[model samples]
Target: MIQFMLVDDESIIVDSLHRLLEGQEDLPLKVWKAYSADEALDLINIIEKTEGQGIDILMSDVMMPGMNGLDLSALIKSRFPELKTLFLSGYSDYTYLQTALHQEAFDYLLKPVDDETVIEAVRKLCLIIEEERRLKEQEKQNGMRLKQAQRMLNDELLRELLEKPLTPQQLADKEESYVQASLSVDQCFILLNGKVDQWPLTYTEIEKMRQREMIMELMVSMLQPQCSIVPYNGSRHLVWLLQVKRMDHDSETCDLPQLHWYLSEELERVQFTIQERMGLSCSFVISGHEVDWLQIGDVNRKMGELLDRAIGLKSEIMQVEQAGEAMSRYQDIQLQPQEIKKQLLALTGLLEAGEFLAFMNELRSFFETIRKSVFLTYERQSEIFITLAGLYLSYMNSRQMTTEVGMKLDLTYLTNFNKHTDWQSFGDYCVRLAEILFLIVGDDAKEQKQEIAEKVDNYIIQNLSRNLTLQQLADHVHLSKFYLSRLYHSQRGYPIYQKIKEQKLNRAKELLLQDDIKIKDVAAELGFENVPYFTTFFRNSLGMSPKEYKQSYQS
Candidate 1:
C-alpha cells in the first residue's frame, strides 16, 4: 500500500487535500494529515518505523510557518531519496518555482488546486514510485543470482585444480581471480581429504548426500577460527584446503608439529560432534607438510593417495610421511595377470551370491596356495592385491556403489608388503571386505521399506516449517511418490498428508504459548500465506483460534 502525507498550517487546506486523496478509490493511499512541518516530520518518522518504508508521496504548501515545503522536500530527499514530493503555493512567484524545481519536486501546483489537477499529479507520481521500486527489486534479485553463479564457478575451479594439470602461470592467474580475494599465496596451506564412515547403510542416496553436506558444514564451523578453509564435495569424499600463516617471527621456520597437534584436537571435537549429533563417524587425512601456493594440487594428490591407503587402519587422522620413507616402501612386483584374472572371476561369483563365509574361506585357500608357490614374490603379491582391489571395484561399479568403499580396505598393508606377515593377515583383510559387501546387499524387501519410512520421518521433522508435499518428500529420499505414500501409510497407520498437517499444528500450538510472538507472524513462519486461513485451520484442529489459544495458555 502506498502512503501519503499532506502538511499545511491552514486546517482548511490540509482537510481539503486529505479528503480529495482519501476519496480516490483507484489509488490505494493511506493519507496522513499534518498541521505543521514539525508534525509532518514526526508522522513520517512514525510511519517509517512502523511500516519499514517511507510515505510514497508528500504534498505540502510551499509557504509554511517554520519550514517551507521546498526545504522540507530537500531534507526528506537526503534521508529517503525514494520519497516523491509535490509542492503547493498560492503565489506564482518565479523564485518559489525555482526553489521547487531545485528541490526536485515531482510537481508544483498553484494553490486553490482543482480536484482533477491534484488527483492527476498524485496518479503520475504513484506510477513513478512503483517503477522505481520494481527496478530496485530487480537489481537486488540480479545481485543474488550473480553471487550464486560466482560460487558455482569457484567450486568448479577448485575441482579442476585437483583433477587437471595446469601451468604455473595459469594456476597463479586462477588463484588471483578467485582464491587471492580471500587468502594470500604467502601463507602456508594444507590440503586434507575427509570421508564420512559408517553412514547409515539404510539411508537413501539423497539422504546420504544431505548428511555429507551437514558433515562438511560441521567441519568448517569447527576449523574456521584457526584458518580459512575451502571445501569441495565429491561423490565419495570431501576435500578441503586449510590455509594458515606462520605466527613465528622467522619466515623460514614453522612449528608444524604444534600446528598438527592443534588440528588433531580440533578434529577430535569434529569427530565427537558428528557422532553425537548425527550418529556418524568421519575419517580425515592431512598433508604431511605445508606446501607453497602453487603446490596445492600436488599436495592434494599426495594426501588422497595416503587417505586411500589408510582406509583400513584404526587411526582416524593419517598424515603423509617423509618422501624418502614413502619412496623406499614402493617395490616392483610381477605376477601372472592371466592366473590372477582366473582367481578374481571365482571370487566375484562368491561375492555375488552373498556367501560371506565361503568368500572368506576361498580367499584364505587362495592365499595359502600362492604362499606355497615359488612365484609369491613381493611384486607378485602387490599385483595380486591390485587385481583383488580392481575386482572389488568392478563389483561395486556394477551395483552403482561409489569408490569411497575402497577406503574400508586395508590398503596400508598393500603399500607395505612386509606388514602382510602371513597368509592369515591377508585373509583377515578379505574377511572385512566381504562383511562390508554383505551388508550392502543383504537387506530384504521388508527391511528396505522400513528404512525408507524412517528416512521420510526424519526429513519431515527437519523441515516442519516448509509446507512439504509428498512428491517433494519422495524426491528427497529417492522414492516414487506412490510407493512412498503407501509405505508411509502402512508404517504410521495414517496418510502422509495428515501427518504433515498434524506436525505443523502441533508445532503451532507450542509456538503460540510464547507471549512475544504475534499470531500472523507465527502463521507465516509455519508456511501459511493467509492469516484467515491459518486461523480457520487452527480453530478446526484445536477448537480455538491462535489468539484464543495464546490467551488460554497465559491464563
Candidate 2:
C-alpha cells in the first residue's frame, strides 16, 4: 500500500485531497493530511515510528505562510531521496515555487484543479513506485539464484576432486577450487566417509539435505579442525576432508599412530553424539594414514570400499589399513578406484536412461575385469559384490519399487555375496536383474506419460477461469517446463497451451448457453483479459460475437 502525505496551509485542500486518494481502490492508498509543513514533518516521524514505514509520495502546497513547500521538499528529498514529490500551485505562485520544485519532481497539479487531475498525477507516481518495487524484488530473486548456482558449481567441483586427479592446467592455474574446498595440496590430510545408516527410501531430497547439513555442523563443532564436507548426491553418504596437522602449535603434526587413535576416538564420539542427539547412526571410515592431495581420488574411493562391506555390525568406524601393510596382497590387483566409481556411476545413469543393452554390456565388462585379476581373492570379490548390489538396491529404493522388484527377482545377492562363489555366478544374476529393470522402465515411461497427460487435461478443464502457464503445468507434474511441453505434445498430439485455448473456447460456449450469465462475466470466467478480447476470439473462432452467439442460441 502506498503511504500518501498531503500538506497545505488550507484545511479544505488537505482534507479533500486526502479523501480523494484514500478511496481509490486501484491505488491501494493510506492517506495522511497536514495543514502546514511543520505538522507534515512531525506526522512523517510519528508514522515512521508507529508503522515502520516512510511516506511514499509527498504532495504539498508551493506557497505557504511559514516554511513553504520549497523548504519541505528540500528536507524530504534530503531525508527520503526515494520519496516521490508533487506540487500544488496557482499561476502567480508558479514562478515563486519554480525554484523550490525540482524540475525532475513528479508532475504538479494546478490550483482550481479537478479531483481527477490530482488523482491522475498521483496515479502516475504510484505506477512509478510500484514498478521500482517490482525491479527491486526481481533483483533480490536474481541474487538468490546466483548464490544457489555458485553453490551447485562448488559441489560439482568437489565431486570431481574426490573422483579424479586435477589436470596439469588446473594445477598450473593454481585453481581456487581446492583452496575453496579447504584441501591443502602441500600438506597431508585425511579423508573420512560417513554413511547415514538406514535412511528411509521415502526421505525426500530436501530432507536428506537438511539432515546432511545438520550432521556436518555437528561434526565440525566437535572436530574443531580445518575441514570441508561434501555429501554424495542421491545417496546417504557424506565425505569430510580434514587437515592432519593442527597449526595451533609448533610441534602439532599428528604422527601416524596418534592420528589413527585420535580419529578413532573423535569419530566414535561423533557417532555416539548422533545416536543420542539426532536419533540417527552414521557408519564411518577414515584413512589409516595421512595422505597427499594428489592421491585424494584413490584414498577416498578406497575408504568408501572399506565402509561398504560390514558383515556383522552397523554404524561401526572402520579405517583403511596402510597400503604397504595389510593392503599389500590386494594392491597389485586393485583397479584405479576413481575409474571404478566412474564406471559404476555411469552404470546407474545407463539404468536411469533405460539403456538395457548398454547396461548389460557395462555390467559384463566390469565383472570380467574383476574375474581376470590373477590376485583376485574372496575378500576383494565380496567388496565388489557389495558395492554393485548397493547401487542396484539404492536405485530400486529411490523408485519405491524395491518390494515389487524383489517379489519378481531374488535380491539375496545384495546382502549375501558369499552365495555367488564365482564372478560368473554373480554376473548372471545381475543380467537377470537388468532384464527386469528394463521391462519396468519401458512400461513405467508409458504409464508416466499417460498420467501426466491426464493431469494436464484435467487441470485445464477445471481451471479455465484461472490464468495458467506451461510452468504451472510443469510444476504440478514436477518436470521442467520445456520437457513437459515436449511430453504433452508427444503424448496428446498437440501443444499443451493449445489445449488450454481450446478448452477455454469450449467452456465459453457452455457458459454462453446460460441466459442469466452476462457476456463480460463469461469472458472473465474463461480467463480472457477483457470483453473485447473475448468478443474477438468468439467471432474469429465461430464467425459471431459472444453477444451474437448468445442471441442465436436464445433463438
Candidate 3:
C-alpha cells in the first residue's frame, strides 16, 4: 500500500487535498493531512516509527509562511530519497517553477487541481515504488544463491587439498579467495585421520552424511577449546587439521610435546562423548611429528598409510611409530597362481550373485590367509594384484564397459611393482582396487533391474491407451507390484506412475496435431473419460487448451 501526505499553510487546502486522495479507493492509498511543512515532517516520522511504512508521495503548496514546499522537498529528498514529491502552486511565475524544477519535483500542478491530475501523478509514483521493491527483492535472493554456491566451492576446495599436494605459494593463493578465514597455514598443525565404525551399511547416502556431520560437529565443539580445527571431506572418513599454538611462545616455536599431550586428552574426551551420546565409535590417527604449513600434504599422506595399517590390524588408535618396523618387514615369497585361482573363482561367484556381505567376507578371508602364510612380499603381492587386475579387466570387457584412464594407469603401477613403499602400502593399494572393481561391476541386482526397466518401457509405449495401473504392469512383467515399482524407479530415475502420465501426454500431443482426430476422441484415446478433464490437464501442462494448441499448429 502507498502512503501520501499533503502540506500547506492554509488548513482548507490541506483538508481538501486529503479528502480528494482519501476518496481514491482504487489507488490503495493511506492519506495524511498537515497544515504546514513542519507538521508533515512530524507525521512522516511518527508513521515511520509506529508502522515502519514511509510515505511514497507528498503533495504540498509551493508558497507558505514558514518552510515552503521547495525547502521541504529538499529536506525530504535528502532524508527519504525514495519518496516522490509533487508541488502545487497558485502563481505561474517562472521563479516558483524554477524552484520546483531545481528541487526535482515529480510533477507541478496549478491551483484548483482536478482529481484526474492528482490520481495520475500518484499512480506514476506507485509504479516506480513497486519496481524498486521488486528489484531490491531480486537482489536479495541473488545474494543468497551466490553465498550458497561459494560455500559449496569452499567445501570442494578443502576436499581437493586432502587428496593432492599443494605448494606453499599455491595454498596461499587459494586462501586469498574464500578459504583464508576457515583454514590457516602460517602455524604448525597436526592432521587427524578419523573414520566412523559400526555405522550400518544399509543407511542411505543422505543419512550417512547427516551422521558424519553430527560426528564432525561434536568433535569440533569438544576440541575447539584446545586448538583450531578445520574439517575436510575424506570420502569414507572424517579428516581435520588441528592447529597447534602456545600462549607462552610464537606458533613457530611452540612446545610440540605439550601440544600433543593436550590434543591427546581432548581427543579422548571427544571419543567418549561420541560413544556416550551418539552410540557410535570412531578411530583416530594423529600425525607423528609437528608439520610446518607447507608440509601438511606430506603429513596427511603419512597419516593415511598409518590409518590403513590400523584398519588391517583392527586397532582403534595407532601412532605412526608403531608401524615403522612392520612396514620394513617385506619378504620375498613365491606366487601360487593355481591356488589363488580357486579362491578368485569362489569370490567371483559371490560378486555375480549380488551377495555383497558374502563377497566382502570371502575377500577378507583370502587376504588374511595370505598374510598368515607368507609375509606378503613385494613380488607375491604384485602377482596377486596382477591376477585381480586381469579379472577386473575381463569383467569390464564382457560388459562392454570402458575403464577410466586413471584406473588403467594405477593398474600399470601395480604391474611395475616398484611403487609399493612397504607391505602395508601395497595392501592398501590392493584393497582400494578391489573397491573400484566392485563399484564398476555393480551388483547383479542392478543388471536385473535394467532388464526389467527396458521391458517396462516397451510395455508403456505399446499400451499407452490402456487404463494402466501399477498392479497391471507388474502382472505383465511377472513381478510383485512393490518390487517392480522400486526397481523401475531406481533404473529410470522417476516413479512409474509419473512416467506413464508423461508418455500418455506425449502421445496425446501427437494425436491432437492430426487433422483427422476430434478433441473428444483424443481424450478418449488417451484413457481420459471426460473431455474437460483432458483439456484441464493439457492447459496445465502447456498453458493452452488442446483446441487452441491445434489451432496454433495450423496457424
Q: Highest lDDT: give the candidate number.
A: 2
Task: Report clash pairs, candidate 2.
Answer: none
- TM-score for model 2? 0.33
Worst 10 residues of 1 by lDDT: 326-335
Compose the digit string of candidate 3's lDDT tens values, residues 84-198: 8889765444467667766767777655344566777787677666656764686596684574455476777776676678786777777665235455555566778886644
- For 1-555, candidate 2 gives per-residue lDDT tens digits of 888899998775677677778788899688899999999999999999988888888888888988988678878778778888788764323244346434346655545455666777787678668756864686596684574465576777777777878665765465576666555555566777876754542243344565676687578667755333333432325787666554564555666456667777888889989888556767777785667667778888776555443221246666666423434544566666566678788887887776655777788788667554433334655656777888788888988888887866668766887554234566767876775665456565676568778998998888888767665776676554445665677677767667887888888899999978899899898876678767876786788888888888688
Instruction: Estimate, for each residue in 1-555, the C-alpha lDDT of model 1 and write its tens digit.
Output: 898989988776687678879999898788999998899899989998998988778888888899888888888788887678888765544467667766767666654345676887788677656655664686596684574466576777777776566577876677676553355555666777887644442343444665776677678778877666777875446887776643453552235455566776788788888888667767787775476666777777766655444323222665666533543333233235577668777887877765554665677667655544422334455667777767666777888764545544445554454454234455555655655564446452446557767888888778876767665786786544444565567667776767777878988998888778888888988877568768877887898888888888688
Per-model lDDT:
0.67, 0.69, 0.67
How big is the positional error of residue 192 in model 2, measured in Å on the Cα after superposition? Answer: 0.6
Return the TM-score for each candidate structure: 0.36, 0.33, 0.38
RMSD of each: 23.6, 21.3, 23.5
Pairs in clash, predicted candidate 1:
333-379, 334-379
- On TM-score, the candidate that comes out on top is 3
Clashing pairs in 3: none
Poorest 10 consecutive residues by lDDT, candidate 2: 227-236
Candidate 3 local Cα displacement, residue 413, angstroms: 21
Report the Cα lDDT for candidate 1.
Answer: 0.67
